[model samples]
Target: MRPPCHAVLPVIACALGALFHATQAAAALKPAQLAIVINDADPDSVAMGEYYRKRRGIPATNVVHVSIPGKPRSIGVAQFRLLKQAIDSKLGPSIQAVLMVWTAPYAVQCNAITAAYTLGYDARQCAHTCAAGQPSAYFNSASKRPYTDHGLRPSMLLPTALPPIAGPPASLAPEQARQGAQALVERGVAAGARSLPASAYYLATSEVARNSRAGFFPPAGHLPAHRLTIRRMTADVLEGAHDVLVYQTGMAQVAKLETLAFVPGALADHLTSHGGDLLGSSQMSSLRWLAAGATASYGTVSEPCNHWQKFPNSAVLLRRYLGGDSAIEAYWKSVAWPAQGLFIGEPLAAPYAVASN
Candidate 1:
């Protein structure tokens, strides 16, 4: 006989571990029938989901992992077929979000066809194109250098008179990484020390939210590329909800250093079109809003992630400003790396709030 669903319950429980926390008193998050489509069986994605499920006390059954066709590196038509099948089988009207892990050619296809056309997170591709077949930067220094047909490479710091760059190289020596970091700090300071953008800050927050204990810091350079991805993904997700809150956290110094780049005007415009507001909350220091878009209201939250032991109380101010859940802080603290003292967690809890909206 096939194993009963409850048989897997223990395994799921073990996998979930310290991550799950129960929510009884607060307003319930409207369930979003979320569907997670993965490129392959990766430890990172699996660990990430487990963290979210247990941290939020979402039932094990609520998180489904669907495997795609093809090798882990290449996401071609076969991979697309599996992804489409997974979505067609599981996605219903109640589903609010679909997160795809890893980059694939089909990822662009899926985002364009499903996220853009079907989910209404549409976008116009920018014309500032990199040369075709120039080569891919699987691993290169933060310098804004052209690429060649190199298979895989190490990261190196370029000389001055160049923009800084960042991102983990597939295989970078420690000395190389150190030099790169130094170069980035110098170049970043010289560039009038511009802040990246609200979206970039949000992405950093997500990484912090997901793996704060991992000691992950944004690489020295590559701020523009980071900003582009964060803006696109957050904008897409926010468009589907009536209100979305993003929490940006860092060391007081780094947070202060990057504050100038959080462009409220650009993010506000994106938010306003979706009938949403973009609020930045920090735990360490303050973030200055450089600009505001026409439709959305842009501002900051005063607290940081470590104070979440007081989640119920801090959220009082958040509800006053954005009008969402109070229990979210409690829920986040129970499961997340609260000791790390990163960003706020309301936006992470937004799915629960904006479900009916």
Candidate 2:
């Protein structure tokens, strides 16, 4: 009972094996084009920001530091406006993409922080949860210089992937989460430029509402030209896969994620009302994909009401990824209405790029 296609990033691998090795080719999103935002209040944010900045070779001028006394889950529009102003004031002209380090504050009102920063805060989206939000000019576009072409800089969050608030206890939770974010950065660097022999799994679950985008899954087959394979399955879950590049499904909480291994620069997420509610108690958060080894993942901060346009179109996502777009670019272009969706992961992982690095 799925309708048609459509629809939107922290992340780059799972096990790091022969299935996906280091790449050497080209990347579209260069280090100089990226800007890193660090929250001085949160220690993890500061540490991961420093590490990712160094690893990616981001220019010193492309860094912005802000202080939020309390790292709340969602900030008020007034506060976000100031935050956005602070960030915008510091970014240089060459900056095209932004990486906000930290898991909390992923949303502003109902709009995801990433969308709010890149597209400007839209109060209309917060006015209605299920209504259509603003359309992105960059959706499915071929523009490489988003900032220069459209005055928008696509943003992604470097999240810890740890279950928010109530989850299993850990002795060194902050340190461990910081390490997790760093590992994600490493995977992104390793994914730079490589021809990956991978598979994209599209699991069609019985959750009819959640499966609205299932029809848009890439035709299940092999593409020898790209050295990629797409699998459209009728099951609710996949098991024992060694090379998972792109995984899209619809469920409140997915099962058996730990059993699979994801290739570097992987994209994985579920479609649901609150998957983007990273700190909310109910339903699984999109951060689980990162913990499960996915490099980038997406989830809606507010209820999207199963609108296909609000989620990432698997067809466009795979096409952009195979066409050599970075994880952030491909993910951002796939979502037409993304004000409510949070894009999380490593933003610059481009495993398929053929350009000179």
Best by TM-score: 2
* lDDT by residue for model 1 (147-219), tens: 1222211111011111111211224464453343233223222222223432322322333332221121111
Q: Write the per-residue lDDT of candidate 2 for residues 186-235, one digit (tens) a residue.
A: 77877765456889999889887898887677676777766788788998
Q: Distance from true position, residue 149, model 1, in Å? A: 48
After the best TM-score superposition of candidate 2, give how far the Cα of residue 125 lies from its true spot, in angstroms. 1.6
Supply candidate 1's per-residue lDDT for 125.
Answer: 21
Candidate 2 lDDT (Cα, 0 to 1):
0.81
